[model samples]
Target: RKPKTLLAGVSGRARPGRVLAIMGPSGSGKTTLLNSLAAQMDKAPGLVLQGEVYVNGEICNQSMASMRKGYVRQEDTFYSQMTVRETLRFVARLKLSPEVPYEDKMAVVESLIKKFSLAKCADTIIG
Candidate 1:
């Protein structure tokens, strides 16, 4: 069971500390590409993967540790009962280093909101 490689000869550079977006019309293989990049898909029958995927100059393999590169899908899932700040605090608690303080986490959250152009909608709670 392997995932298919959907793109070939695609090249682009995302500079460090820059925001990136993946935009396209419906059925444009955006999720497929993201799945392959994240290597987070569940095993399924009849899937065939070709070519290679490298993250931070390392090929994707079983031994690779949990990848930290942020890849947010278009329709992300979140709990309905949590406030925006609570949800973000939970996420930050899970992702940020243990030594990072609450203020640093809040700063990271604010920066991510600005980075994602989600400032205006940051306070909105998910339903």
Candidate 2:
């Protein structure tokens, strides 16, 4: 079987204190590139994934990328009936490692709430 290349020759810069958005039509490998950069891409048979990710000017491997970076999907897949905190907790439970204790996950959720300045709306329902 022939191997398919999902992304190649893709390069860009992301400066701190700024927002970087990857925009493209559907099936253009935006998610693929993001997963590769965030080290979240799952391995598949015959998949030859090769790339170097750098954060804060230092080269990072998969584990390093996991620790230093986070990815928020472009779509709004959360339930509108859930409050802000509920939504965050739900996602945290899904994304954080299973070995992470419940208390720890909640702590991380709280940290994210504060970091993103969502405390005021923590209990506000998404309408």
Q: Which prediction has the highest TM-score against the true structure?
A: 2
TM-score to true structure, per model: 0.49, 0.63
Clashing pairs in 1: none
Kindly list the per-residue Cα lDDT of model 2 for residues 7-102, writing each as its tens digit: 888878888778898999999998888877766567334455776666766778556765755579667788999999999999999999999999
RMSD of 1: 7.4
Error of 1 at 11 (Å): 2.7
Over the full model, what C-alpha lDDT does candidate 1 score relative to the true structure? 0.71
Supply the TM-score for candidate 2: 0.63
Give stretches of model 2 more than 4 Å off.
43-47, 54-59, 62-67, 75-77, 88-117
Task: Return the lDDT, model 1, position 47.
Answer: 47
Q: Against the true structure, what is every candidate's RMSD?
A: 7.4, 4.5
lDDT by residue (1-127, candidate 1, tens digit) is 4554556665455678899777788877667667666674443344445677765676767666364578776676687777666678789988899999989998888787778887676777767
What's the TM for model 1? Answer: 0.49
- Which whole-number lDDT from 0 to 100 does residue 15 have in model 1? 72
